[model samples]
Target: MSVFLAIVLLSLNVGRSGGAIKPVVTFTPNWGNILYLDDVTLTCDVPSTAPEEPRTYHWYKDKRPIPGDQQTLHIIESLGRDSGDYQCQTIGGDISDPVFLNVTERYVLLQRLPSLIYEGDPLTLRCHHHRFCKAINPKFYKDDQEIKPSGSDSTFHIPNITRSQSGRYKCTKQIQPCYTPNVQELSDESFISVKELFSPPEIKVPPSRVIEGDEMTVRCDTRLDPLRGGTKLHFAFYKDGWTVRGYDVSDTYRVPSSQLEDSGKYTCEVRTRSDTVRKRSDGLYIQIYELFSSPQIKVPPSRVIEGGEMMVRCDTRRDPLRGGTELHFAFYRDGRTVRGYDVSDTYRVPSSQLEDSGKYTCAVRMTSDTVRKMSDGIYIQIYELFSPLKIKVTPSRVIERDEMTVRCDTRLDPLRGGTELHFAFYRDGRTVRGYDVSDTYRVPSSQLENSGNYTCEVRTRSDTVRKRSDGLYIQIYELFSPPEIKVTPSRVIKGGEMTVRCDTRLDPLRGGTVLHFAFYRDGRTVRGYDVSDTYRVPSSQPEDSGNYTCEVRMRSDSVRKMSDELYIQIHELFSPPEIKVTPSRVIEGDEMTVRCDTRLDPLRGGTELHFAFCRDGRTVRGYNVSDTYRVPSSQLEDSGNYTCEVRTASDTVRKMSDGLYIQIHDYKMQNIIRLGISGFVLSAAVCFIYFHNKW
Candidate 1:
């Protein structure tokens, strides 16, 4: 028995003269530490204070009895789950306290992070083997070749990784002789891939906001760059968590008529030809709206009287394509907002009064959209039950260049209706034609200034009670006059400034109203056109040379007219610049310079020029305001073809210079001969020393 077990027996015997001996666990070779791929042995021991034969002993791991016979347990190879607290028990003696034993690994393993590490990104490789002891003098290898000398490091790092770094990598861990172990060395290997393209596919839809009955196109916007590798990509389109189409090479999927069911979460999946890589985009939700036309409201009986009932009806000429037949209605009295809200299509006034004598309007709204159509207001007047003092306008819907007439109804009703009434017309609370005993107001041709709310007041020549009619709102459009773009100096240059003005003339005889101006270049509105009449460019570039025009919108009538496109030509000094080297090629001890020529002799008189030189896509000389790049000392390293760039003061219209090849030849014949003679003398002296030693 072990000394620890004997001690436990003595303690139990001393405490109680007739007590049972305690049970304990023991390990073989006097060891308990376990390692991966290592074998270990265990035994259970029990003792009795009495001098009789002892009972049987059993072994338990983690306080649970395992299936086995005898008093010993041997583990051939320790695994991760073998680590636990062990105990032993006898028939009568108390079971032993838990004895903790941990199993660890010693084999080397290669690992990498679970994140994407693309080319040009920092990369790291780790060797996991130093669990029980330190790995001394570790070495890293690539493609079975040593990359560095043996050092005490387990991690290899590359600052800026490139595609060339893709290869099989491995690491070696050396166990120095001083360590007490059978293992001498360990190695781990893994393959690494440096990706160059890792971007996912993007999705788009034509007609961003879709409506029912519209032709729709759902596109997966991914195109291969011709300059890159030739890798075929397969596309898949998905909607509402299910594949709509798959295994296709095209990037777009078309639908003849997009409906409400076509709108849902949409996503696109892009995969490589070999299916080795895949990427999916996030879902995009779409909603399709219905289409509807403007609605109109009808008034019955054509007239209203005080203390009489009347009905107003709102209706849409055609129903919308959107679902559901239910609709909502809203009415406005004077300008707008007669009441909060109403859902009935028919608005009935139980009793007409003078307060309800103003203009009335109605509109119909679909439940799915906030868009609704507003009907032109209809005037309804409330008069005495039998009064005949009435006024109205002929040709109520009058456009520009049209005539309108305002006439008071002179025919009196058969029952006490007023007659012989003087006429007074008021526009927006101001009298236009006073009570001058006239019954008609006529306009030969209406103008934009004639748009206003008009009302008429009439009274019999015998009665003093003046009756007023409901107001009528009219809109008079203005005639459109296209504006023209006027460029100062008529001609523009790339490096020079120019001013652009929008000029138009309205009817000068009757026009003092301000006009809003806007400018356009190639049909797109230019900035600062909303608040300014003229646009100016301090320095123009080649991109600013396009078709330009101006637009004039009438502020009062909201009438817009566009001018003809003007092809603006901006002169360029460097159409196709040329680069030249005077001698082209030279030997050592020759002076050289690269000249940049614009080939525009006529425009070079007052032009401010700048020059630059480049080699191997890198700048050799930059931002030099000169036309010539003189090389101080021409050498063989400067023999590659050089490119030059010539720019003007504007710096936006620069031209590239043709490549100039400069070859430099060596002229060191004498120096070569001197080196040969020196080498021969040194060889002969070494031979003479060897022969002297032999003698």
Candidate 2:
């Protein structure tokens, strides 16, 4: 940390040290600017509480490391080479800021002690010349104006220095023997700067925003040069320019329990123990917030209802910073205590009467009663149990197929929040919904007949305090027109695409209402209800020919309509193929032929047809113009089931014929010959075996 601090100070040229104390460099002869061959001593002053002991020191010139390990560096007969910026540091301490020294080889030179001058510091100036010359007389001049009378002494001093005393200064002297061959020796003018002893003090308050009853601490901040560390400083605090604390070594003032009235401008004064250097911080404004706001008497109901339960609440807000603080409340009536302090913020009356009306007030305070506040009185008026009832209808313009709700509106004291109220609805002076705990009557789907003058009555559970609302007239409008089925391409043909659309005219006022459509054929659902208004059949067949109808309705399935049935006939494009066999009874040498017989509709005569033949599920011939398969020679191996298939040239219409069985009869003479051969071979084998045994 010490090494880091030294590096930071040197790199940033920082004036104040934040960590370890920084060493201060002071010259023994004080004046840094001098004539050649002048002897001077530089000392490194470090503040410490430890006993004196051998300590290591480092020195630098012009930011470069130099050779110096002692606390003091003495320059014997300083020469021009000695002129440069000097800095020093000690082990485990911060490095000091650089101080510049100037050396000139002139006949005369003007210098000031304590190269760095500050307000309230003593200052000394010397009119110097070469040692070989003896000065006859010397005088000091500031800003080219004579400041000191001619005298034999070469030194001039000021008891205390101020900023106004800073300017260019030079000295004039008469030497007995001058190297320049001039009688009067004049020193070059040098600039002097007077710096402040300490920066201005600033008032600081942590957690700038403070709440009442919270501890607050105020601080005064200022910086004094380390070179002036020995100077003692005293601090004093003020509020609105009035002294709150007298001079003291401490720079902080604390308040144990802050209050709202304590909010004001605050400032602090810093001065040297000798009362020489004084500085006051600028005024800072501070505001103390209330721990909890003043209590206010609040009645839930605008008008208190007679014979009803009444509840009064003392409402107050606490500072968010002190959210967990507990508070006590009290209630007053006509300047008399109606309820003593309690943790609860409310005062309740089981049954309120007209006599309960009076001026009410509430008081609140913290648990310790360190701060207490009361609200201004409020006058409460009590009246009947309820306000006049009024009827309200949602969506005043009711539409068919829309849900409607009618409510009996009335105001009841909130104190009776749990009290059960019964409500009844009427239509055209006839009761629609009987009295119940509900205050509203709802209609799932309204029709034209439901449109009439509607009214409602509200009453307490015991039938007491009944109020009737004025009648409200409602008119239900048709939501949409009847829907009809629309088929594209008026005439539908087999093997062709067909589309059925449901058509309806929705009321403009009911635009954006979602409707679902469904398609049916022969009284059976062909398509389920969906948002689409059209249903499509990719390819129509004879089976698709039926009494078709479409349905349209609201998403709620309310007010549904079905289109009139329409007869749709799909003209056949082609008939299913059938298998035909020639020479049904097969003989051993008879030739057999199978054919796929199919008839195309006359209306589609231009459509080309292709056929294929299969024997027991195996293709005997691929699709071609020939639809017949022939067996040139009838044999038992060729006696199997055969099938035929036919399709249009585009392969859109395909059909297969039923299987047909064929049986081939083998010649009886051939079978008998095969049996005779087998018997002869067996007989020969037996004869051979007998002959071999005899031999």
Candidate 3:
């Protein structure tokens, strides 16, 4: 068959060449396989618009001009020898692209894809058999080598294709359910080409600092080769591996309002007309800032007294991701400036005063931003100072040994309640007690030493305006020893005047001092409150017999001194009392009584008198108002000297008793002699009677 088709092609080409200039030629049914004995036609084209212009065709096989007939149709019969690449030229010098023709008696076919491809692209090939049946497990090869697909598919697909994959490629497939595994059909040869028309997309942002509610624009740009002109491009934006915006034909994108979620790793992708050819850019950091909270003013100690230290601070809440933002602070007092533009938040006052009081506020914001916030107002009030004090003494009339209170009173403003005050006490233009914060000073025990003109000094914080009170006189008295009562004779007869004097031990240290005198008897005042030292009774009487004491004091007496007591006695006349006994010569068997009486004292007028009767200088009878002595029977023992005494109550003025003597005789001895004479006469008669009875 090959020998016969060669002979037929040689006869057709004989004497067909040698045309003028050049023209274009083509075969009808421009693409696809032509089966054996298929009717085909060719046309010779010329660029000249005139129909009368003469034209001719020139044909070539495998890039060599062939001598063919000048007719426009080149026909192929039974196709074995006519299978080749053919090009043609017109007589007017126009050339045409060569087209390939292949004819085979085998029932297998191979399909080819586009020859020109971008670097990042995919390639596909299809193989078919004239039997019109499916084939499984197809294999493809480049330059007679096999192309192994990554997965199980009959058709071959090369993914992410590059320029290195360019070569002649062919594919083969076995008939499905065939008994022999080695039986395969071959496909027609085809060439592949690769061109670098893309670089990685570069992403950029005009403004690096993007906050919430801010508009942002993103650009993904790529370089292109002029040789790949008219290539279509698509763009995509990605965040953290997820697509922020799907691929679109536009290169740059706009975001109206960026949010906190928009902050992350961002990238862009650029693509050619083919979807598989694309470049992704490196990640760009896009951060969205959050707004900062309003500033607040803080005071360390809310309450403070005058002259105390305090601290004020300004603060705010912010997002930590604001990498380069700095916070600045300013303080205001009642709309006036206190501190301006201070980076530090704290302001301090070492000592607060009344003039330093007002409403306070603080303003804070970021240095990079124009917005700032001012805090609410806080108040600081300074109290008026405690000053111009006065002194007061308790118990206006203070006596010796009396406890006293000295108070230093200062004017206080209730608005400033925390004022602290210090005070001191003075006496006789000298400090009596040290300075103390307490306003009251107490004298535990007041003595003569405490007697002086007293004053006080009140102060707050050293009493810048010192004040003193008027002097107060405090008088006291000293205690003296007891007074003495002296009498002229010390003893006085009844009915006579006696001199009595109240004498005190006058202190030599206080010589010639004016003193007051008072006299007391038995704890009762007798002569009271007199300047005279002597307290004399006009006449001394028995009633003057009592205990006497004297008291002495200064003219300005707050307290007095009492004297030891002395007893006084006024007596009667020295004559003895007379005594009398009834029946002075009474016999021994008779009853007797005795009586004695003393002379009554004229000074003791109407005073009840007491008397006693004495025998042999001893009291033997009554000492009562009844001044009589009596015996029931006069016996020999009752015959003795008898006397009586006279005295008043307390036995102060008593008189001695007078003595008397009495005699007595025995009456029974005389009656016994007469009885003996009568008994002798009776004895003579008894002797005569006894002699007569015995005979």
Best by TM-score: 2
Question: Per-residue alpha-carbon lDDT of model 3 for 22-101, expressed as tens digits?
Answer: 34344554323454564456555443432565556677877888776464665756376767777777664545555566
Error of 2 at 280 (Å): 2.5
Off by over 4 Å in 2: 1-26, 41-101, 130-166, 173-185, 196-198, 206-208, 221-234, 247-252, 272-275, 295-325, 330-340, 345-363, 368-370, 374-695
TM-score, per-candidate, Cα-based? 0.29, 0.40, 0.33
lDDT of 1 by residue, 270-354 (tens): 8765565567878888776554445566777676655457677776643344444556778778876664346678778876666
At residue 574, give the lDDT of candidate 3. Answer: 37
Candidate rank order under TM-score: 2, 3, 1
RMSD to native, candidate 2: 32.0
Greater-TM-score candidate between 2 and 3: 2
Count of backbone collisions in candidate 3: 12
The per-prediction CA RMSD against the true structure, in angstroms, equals 52.2, 32.0, 21.1
Q: Which residue runs does candidate 3 get wrong by more than 4 Å?
A: 1-109, 112-124, 132-138, 142-145, 149-153, 157-169, 173-185, 189-199, 208-280, 285-363, 366-695
Model 3 reaches what TM-score against the true structure?
Answer: 0.33
Per-residue lDDT tens digits of candidate 2, residues 621-688? 89998878888878777877888888878776678888887777687866898899999999999999
Clash number by candidate, in order: 0, 0, 12
Which stretches of candidate 1 lie above 4 Å from their native place?
A: 1-480, 528-531, 600-604, 617-625, 649-658, 666-695
What's the TM for model 1? Answer: 0.29
